[model samples]
Target chain A: MSNHDTHEHGDPIAEIKKVTIILSVLTIIELILGFWMIGVTSEGGRLAIKGTIVILMLAKAFYIVAYFMHLKHELKNLIMTIVVPLALFIWFITAFLSDGNSFRNLRNTYDPHFKEQATIKVEAKEGHHGEEGAHATEAKEAAPATEAKEAAPAKAAETEKK
Target chain B: MSNVTTASTKEAKWWNGGKSPFDVEYGKVMMWYFLMSDAFTFGAFLIAYGTVRFSTNGWPNPNEVFKSYPFAGEGTNAPLVFVSIMTFILIVSSVTMVLAVHAGKMMDKKGVVRNMILTIIGGIAFLSCQAWEWNHLHHEGAWWGMNPFINADGTASSTNFTNFFFTITGFHGFHVFSGVVINIIMLIMTLTNQFEKRGHYLMIEKAGLYWHFVDLVWVFVFTCFYLL
Candidate 1:
């Protein structure tokens, strides 16, 4: 190939390397931020840390897609073909997440009475031994270790049979 | 073959010195379209995961749940350090893949082969790390069930959340494994001078696109699953 053809080909490999280095540095920063965020107590500080990490991740993603995937060099129509579908999909995600989140909120606030009744039934099923009753009640208040353990074995057996 | 006919049509159009509609090589154009379709599949899976996660009132903190190693009893002390190392390994492999593509462009066969070997090794390491992660997750008492949130009564608040997490990540891991296999094949082909007669290193470039896509998807996975 002539020097002109060489130049026309453009050293995408070199560009890819440059982007790779940037992504590496950003990933290290993400790791540090992730560790640091785990130590933060304040909600605002946590949010800031999360927002920064998410932004950095998106930046890394953009670099890989644009450079490695050669989207930057592609025709405008091709780019739109790839991007528009992604935008539409994000809309679906948003709608589903909003509905799901609302359902969870309703369950947490408005359905506690039904949940308590369910817990009572579970306690009854476990024979309601004095210590076990206390544990079950505590599990209802905190994490439900006993119920998970009991349910887990039964599920495992069923799955094994399947 | 149909492909030959299509190639002939493409050549006839470009043979007359007319601009190709896509402004990209046919192989490259096809790869983009394939990737776009794949992206939609991945997007659907992720959206499903988000729906399930949102439906759960008390999702288990991923940092806590994924922290335990083989022997370490579950506790706050374990901090998912293994995944961090896996992430670093994958990033390094991506860098080596770029270097391989660089060597291919420069027509340095030795450099290409060396870097491809290194890239393949990095890929294997990544696979091993993923295997370890999978084993850890699937072990009994490790709660392979897909409940992102632990209910107050200690049962999974929603099994759907955990199921989606595992299925999506597992599918992505399978893709990585296949990519590594392809990289290995390309590496062997290069060592044997398969591309020497072709007079071009487009295969390396294509593989680089694929390897980079795996890395890109992982970046999103890391954000949505681990960081979020």
Candidate 2:
């Protein structure tokens, strides 16, 4: 290339090395946190650990974008143009996750037969007709395990017999 | 457009503007725009993942699910050691990409070529590691053909987590694969004197932006999928 003077960007080697180090450090910290949090049983402790690791992850992301991708040196508007729209995704996540959670809660409450144990509860509300009712009652009596949650495992083993 | 008069341009001068409006070359400005949109795309995928995770009653423990490493067979030393290595590969590749862009500015064709090659190799290595992980997961039991959600039958399966795991990582893996492909083409062009003939290696710099974006996405993936 003849006109090296045309592209007058500064030497990025030093910044690259710094970023590499920072990233490595963050990675190590996250690894340690992941493992350490595994043993933590308390919900609060786990959430706190999750928060810490997320912050570290974002830090690494910033270095990769700014130094390696060269965005840090670019015009401020260029950065804003990206960040402004990207910020909306946070809202999207919040909206969707809450909606999904509500859906799950509704399913768990109403879909009693959806899980094995919920079968007994549904059977109580369900009325039986003449001849089939007696045979079905006999079948229910033949089955083992009364706990609702055990319904799944009990049904699984019962099916194995067939 | 209505004309706005300025002091220096009182006469009809040859110059139209003093500096680039975006304050960068047209190619670079466009690349940034492309990457920004792409970042949001990845963000939406991750958000969907988080939604699925929250909605599911029994989300598989990611650490337990990802415990196996390549060749260790079944139980492994650390849950996320392999993915951590993958992360390292991408991070180092981003660094090499920086060197490539730096070399491009200095007009060192050889340095640019070498670093681009290294970056490409790193990308390939990352994809290989991912494939290994996927294969290991398959044999360890969840594949596309087998549904993790066995429903009311009570089979020991990972219904929700597996779905999102495959979806999110597969998407990011696709991105990494494409970045590698782009780098290979850029490498070929660099070696064949395409950019040299153009008098600047901005091509390498642009590819570096893409490589860094891929790495950036991996950071989020590693956190959301493996670590968190």
Candidate 3:
């Protein structure tokens, strides 16, 4: 049979090669920009560098899905089957980030001093007798704040020197 | 009696061939379904990663942590250049895979073999590059501002973010390694004239799909883990 007869079967290989070249060139350009902008001083410069990298990454992803995955040739229903799930997945990521951030904020509000005091008390009463243990526990409870207060002058002196 | 049987066989053959609804092969359709499932699996991992990153306070800046290589040690300020190279290598391999697929379509088995070999090499090279990046990250000491649980010495203690970094990227790297083996097997099959007899290079085309998937995952990882 002539090649024309076989053409209906789809020529994936030809499409793959064209897409690959485009992806490779784009990747190389991304690498170059990543290197050249290594010492970007300004915040704008930093954002610019970040933006370029993200854009290149997306471009690479687009080529792979479009060509390698055969989404380019698939029927509309099949393409939607792939794309819709992907959008929902991104939404989940956003939600996860928000929840995680909120939890972190709540954790930050608890007093670190209380945790430090509790830790010291747990350590100091390791092996003492009943009365000694109680005294040691009380002392441990009070010690961190006193120590913290005492250390303030030293910290102040250090700051003055700086 | 023989004439009667022959007439019945002819009628059945015409009916079966005239209006077949499904023209595509079962294996090809199945591969597409499998790919869709795999994409969801990866999406779940990425979303989990985002959750962890969000929950943590003072997440390390990707640009600061992943500065370019070669001069990375000089200022400790360069962005993730090595990872970017790894990304580039993968993209290049995807290209080679496409070229191989093209050669397969033309029935130039020699070209297919050469391009497949090139693609395999690219994959191996990318994996090696990733290994080096991981080693560097592991040896770097933990940062001070990281999650502090305090130690016996009254000093602030921290956990290694490197561990999480390695886990996510390492898992993806293993996938790439598997893809390489798959490519090698497909290459061997192509060389034996297996595809030639079938009059199609569907096996190579499927391999291209897999290789491209690897590239796609890395793109997201590179952004979320290295470029963010």
Candidate 4:
């Protein structure tokens, strides 16, 4: 502890307060955007909102890591050691997500059942029950729900044989 | 001799052999790297989630699934309200952790204990909220392979929705659980005057890092599962 005189000479308590406020505000904005997203029906608008949420999410992460975790105050070497390897995530996300998109395209093109499932709209049940009724009907509801779930995979398997 | 001098001088003062390169202790460095590896773990899980979500044609809209709060009755339509509360709890607890670390820097045991206790309370509160949400979902028949909700477009959805939800959130919850345990142990050590005898509360700083990492992970998990 004696050898560690590396922390910046500043009012750390004040800095903590500032960072806390920033994190909270970021979260609130993100929530607002989330609520806005629910009301937005257009695909482009939802994407723009979602993209903003992501940027805000990254900002919140930066504040948490830089201030709360004190990474920004650390030595340059230490910071590089930590941050550089994280670059791997860029390619990680790109490759995986692109592959996923490709997989979806392939499935939709070849897998008849997969395409059919998307087109088949089931009735929206009165799924959410009152708190008092929830407990009583939990068991009764589980039977049909599980039966439907089981039937889905069975149907997929039957389709595969064709 | 000139070449050797140039090479030696190129290295920063802290990087010189007589002192630690990072100007911090080995414990803190290890904790950072541990968190780094842990970040990859979470990243992989989230990426896998993204992969599955992209590959699937339909998904349960989070707004529909997470639209209830505690004591708000079973048919509440309040999306993101409960989760926002949970998010604030974690952020506030993280602030308390910062205070604990700051108090440790000032050698104030009382401040450290108070903040640590508050942090533990926050952790427990978050876990309780999660328990309620999970129970609610379970009641609605959402489990590893069971999903009661349909896709946003009113299509028959895949079980992957419930499957990924449980696995990722469950993993993050496990991290939170472990973080609480670590904080509890730190609390006990503080109470026993262990850091007092050692003349430093570096251990608390390390614990704070772990706790903040837990909070950090929650940011991603919340966005991935609840918000996005």
lDDT of 3 by residue, A1-162 (tens): 113223444555556557767877876776677566555657698678877777887787777787776575554545665678678766776788788777656655675752353334222212111111212334446554423223333323323543
True contacts kept of 2: 0.50
lDDT of 3 by residue, B63-93 (tens): 5455536434544545665776787788778
* Candidate 3 Cα outliers beyond 4 Å, as residue runs: A1-56, A110-162, B1-24, B67-78, B141-160
Compare the candidates by lDDT and give the number of the best one. 4
lDDT of 2 by residue, A10-71 (tens): 54566667778988998999999999988997889999999999999889877777777766
TM-score comparison, 1 vs 2, better candidate: 2
The clash numbers for all candidates, in the given order, read 6, 1, 9, 0
For candidate 4, report its TM-score: 0.88
TM-score of chain B of each: 0.83, 0.85, 0.77, 0.94
The order by descending lDDT is 4, 2, 1, 3
Q: State model 2's lDDT.
A: 0.71
Report the error of model 3 at residue B89, Å: 1.2
Ranking by DockQ: 4, 1, 2, 3
- Which lDDT tens digits does candidate 1 get at residues B139-199? 4233445222343344334456457667878888987988889898888888888887777
Worst 10 residues of 1 chain B by lDDT: B146-155
Give the Cα error of residue A60 in candidate 1, in Å: 0.9
The interface RMSD values of the models, given in order, are 8.2, 11.9, 14.3, 6.3
Q: What is the C-alpha local distance difference test score of each model?
A: 0.68, 0.71, 0.63, 0.83
